[model samples]
Target: MKHFPIFLAMEGQKLVLSGGGDAALAKLRLLMKTEARIEVFTADPAPVIVTWAGEDRLNLTARALQPGDVAGAVLFYAADEDAREDARTSAIARAEGALVNIVDNLADSQFITPAIVDRDPVTVAIGTEGAAPVLARAIKRDLEERLPVTLGALTRIGKRFRRAAEALPFGRKRRDFWADYYFTTGPRALAEDGPQGAEEALNTLLDTHLNAAPRAGHVALVGAGPGDPELLTLKARRALDEADVIIHDRLIAPEILELARREATLIDVGKEGFGPSTDQTRIAALMTRHARTGAQIVRLKSGDPAIYGRLDEELTALDAAGVGWSIIPGLTAASAAAASIGQSLTQRGRNSSLRILTGHDTKGFAEQDWAALARPGTAAAIYMAKRGARFLQGRLLMHGASPQTPVTIVENASRADQTVLQSCLATLAADLDRAEMSGPAILLYGLAPRAALAEIPQVPEAAHGP
Candidate 1:
């Protein structure tokens, strides 16, 4: 950072300008917007500056720059065309401890003016750290379009509420109430009736929730991401915004949770393999109960709700109770894992079919239709198969699967700690055991694995027998 950019509040402060031409007039106009007392020194005043002084809009002196004139000024601007004069003015201003801006000479100045968009009380300043003012202005233009004109009104409403809110007994509780109101009522009011509407909305919210306890709510199964928030489906974001309660798993990143309404209840219901599991039935019942009382429940899952998310049982219970519910599909870990390695699971010639199955079956591997997974050109992606890899591999081999079939196990797919282990079907178990990779691993078998193996370097074979 070339310059530590800051917003200087110049209201009711002294500002000194040393020119009266078009460039100087522009700076004068900006300074006038603030409550600053501006003193301008010009050898010859421009027509525009004369008109402003004549109307008492600006205070000016028609004289050359003097060393004593810059004293006690908070900010100074030197816009003269003469380089020597500009440098002299800058040196004097700096010696006097005033932040100075030398127009068109970034290197000679201690401060550079930023391109500003003032929707006042909500001013936005854009700077390129004195590198590119034109580029900064272009960016500011783009931002001006996305920022609503009503944001100024919204900010004013917040100003109105600050004192009242601070006076409330419970800081967190008061902040929570206003936050909820700001999103729900205040925005709507601002959109409908501008500042007046926002004021009314804030007042109503403060009055209504003054003595209230936080409401009870159920959990929602929200899919945080396959990795990126931009990849989040519209439905997923909507679920998060509406959720009164969020019970997210460990796989969901903090960045994803930031999308939720700031005041929404957040709970970590994260569980790892065979560790302190949250009862599915209990979760379902909690959601059902919360929904009955008009609370929005979100049970945030890691991936697409339909894929290995235990949705079948939750949906069954929700439906049986007649609770209104819906599912928002997310980028599943399988798709993300394949994407991370740049290997398409449904590659045309390498694999014509895709099968997703879990390695662990409650009834054991004997009950699983391992034969179906042995088909040629079929690619199977196994979920949570680290512990049962040996049994599962043996079953696939017995069911006519090729002993040399390519396999890839991806752990923590799409995450920073992601690791991919490539091995043949014969060595799948030993390779997995050697890597000691666990926690929701995805197993890719068959031709897709062949494609992936062909792309990535192979791992050394395990010493143990296949």
Candidate 2:
């Protein structure tokens, strides 16, 4: 970020501006909203600038800025309407140790201003680091409409009542009380009986919550999608936001994990193919233990949890623990891989059915119906197939599969580092070896990247079968 967004206490700070035209007027209007003492310096003053000076809204100097003019100013603005003059005044302000902002000249500014949505104590700042002012303004407009004008009043009243509300236990209980007041009880009471009634409502609401039973723990088995944050379902996002304990798989993207609350406890129980991994029993135990503490737990898995994600085993464990749970499905890697290659898992004449397979199981390399899989027009998305390429190749070829049958390997599917390798059954193992793929990948049998079709060499008909 070119400028880190923060709210500064401007109650008694000095803010200097060097301009007399629209640019200066625009900045002054926003500055006046703050409690800062605004000072303007320009040789040729506009009518409104003079009016503001007369009203004592700001102290106006009828002359161009000189060296040390902004010596004690905390913030300086060079909105002089001319590039050369702005640069000169900006240099002066910088020399005087003031953070300078050159209007329309982002490269020369020390800090860039963000578009703001004002709801007093509940203000929202939207910035694009000087990349897209229009987009920032658009977001500001949207937020302004959504936030009620009464929000400021509610927040101010709630601020004074914070100490009184501390009588309830901290953490969830306290949070629940505030949530009810801000979202429900408080708003209803204020609309009917003004600010005084809102205070009465707060006291009444607190008493009810103080005597209520403690909240029960629950679990949400959420799917994070194929390494893409945007592909994650809204329900899954909400689970992350509210989750107190997040036990996620290693395959889940760092970006996806970033969506969770900063205070949330993140535990990585990653299980790599043919590598050291957290035992399934231990993962279940962690969920049950956290849930027993009345904590909201989220079992964040990559892709659709119901598909080959060992959903049944985890659900069985949760059932035994007597903890309630819900599932939020997401886009599987197979679907994302197909989309990346511009192919469908099922086609009208090529394949009528789609199958999802794993490269290995508890014992070793997983077994499949090789005879059927070797047939022409059959399609499958083989997950974790990178490490078992040779086993897959030998099995399919032994079942009379053509050496020329197209195969594609999609690595890091739906992610920024995604790569696609096009090969055939004869060279599937060899090509995968040469690629040196390190990320999670899916192997597509009887399919090739649509765009790379003409580029792939075809095998002779005589070599169709083993």
Candidate 3:
């Protein structure tokens, strides 16, 4: 790491800053939140700074930073636009034993200011180690959306109750108390009656939880949308954040998995198409086992769990074991694939209905109504189709599917590394092999990727001979 992250004790400390431009104002905006007494030195101070000083917001002086100006300062910012001035001011601050930051100068800065999401007492600071400020700001924005504005208020209330909660046993018991308060009781009370009601709710929660048995765990079957973490539904993300245990598929993206709670137990129950696989029974057993132990379990799947995800089998097992569970739908590969190609699954004057088919199943090479699927204007998205590409090609061709029918193979849909190969039904197998595509791909029949940046090779006009 280029720099270490530390939260300084700013109470009764001094913060020195220089400059009168936008940079100074930007730093001042965030620095105003700190408990430190702020001092600004500038030859020509901005009017806003003078007004702030008049209002007792900060101490402003109209002069260049002199020696001893940074005495006893915990932090200093040289926001001068001129490099020479910044260098000079930073030197004076450093001589006084204060950590100095030169605005926009990473190499010369002793510390970098992170993009911060402030909720008063609840603050989230994201740093890219002075590498990518834009990326850091994007992350901060995402967190701003995920976190509620009232979180700080709830945290403040929780802080007041910490003494009372200490009556409970430390470690797991205390953690459970906080968890229940934050996830359920606290939010519910705040919504129903506002912050004042939350206090009563917290007290009731403490009393009930302190006297009651430990919480019983439940299961959440969450669909981690096709590759891209941004495509994940709000509910799915919540399930991951609250999960005590995450049982994920092999195809689930690492970025998506990173969203899970840091302390959560992550189990890779990945099953391969024709390779090593986890037994279905074993997966269900794991779910029930974790739930029975009072752990909040999340069964994380790659795409929508309803389609070709063997969802019924797991649901049956959970039901038989008397386990409580809920499902969070995700954007299936089909929808993502369709989006990648800039086309809808069903279009006007084209296909009126859509079908989702699996390339293979427990019996191997899933059997479907090829005659119905081969009809003109029929649209279908075939999953697990990589290995069974040839089987699908032969069946569709034999069932009167036009050899010139448009086919688009979307690999790693909605991901940074996504690839789209456009071809005809006749050359689907050959095109897939030539592409050397390896990611989880979906095959689209009667659909072709629209004009985009991708260099899609044109399908031959003449159909290949059988």
Best-performing candidate as measured by lDDT = 2
Q: TM-score winner between 2 and 3, please give it.
A: 2
* Model 1: worst 10 consecutive residues (lDDT sum): 457-466
Candidate 1, pairs of clashing residues: 219-298, 220-297, 220-298, 220-299, 221-298, 221-299, 222-299, 222-300
lDDT of 2 at 365: 96
lDDT of 3 by residue, 1-466 (tens): 7777777788878999999889999999999998889999998988899999999989998999999999999899999899999999999999999998999999988888899999878888889988889999899999999999989889999999999999897755688889899878898899899999998898889888789887787999999989899999999988898888999999999999999888889999999999999999999999999999888899999999988788999999999999999999999999999999998999988788999998998889998998888777789999999999999999989987778788999999999999999988889999999999988999998888777414544444243222
Q: Which pairs clash in model 2?
A: none
- How high is each candidate's TM-score? 0.66, 0.92, 0.79
Model 2 agreement with the true structure over 313-346: per-residue lDDT tens digits: 9999999999999999999999999999999999
lDDT-better candidate, 1 vs 2:
2
Instruction: Kindly state the number of residue pairs that clash in model 3.
Output: 0
Model 1 has an lDDT value of 0.77
Model 3: which residue pairs collide? none
Task: Summarize candidate 1's per-residue lDDT along 382-458 as a digit string, tens digits.
Answer: 87788888988888888877677778888877777778887878898999989987556788776344345556433
Query: Residue 269 in model 2: shift from native, Å?
Result: 1.4
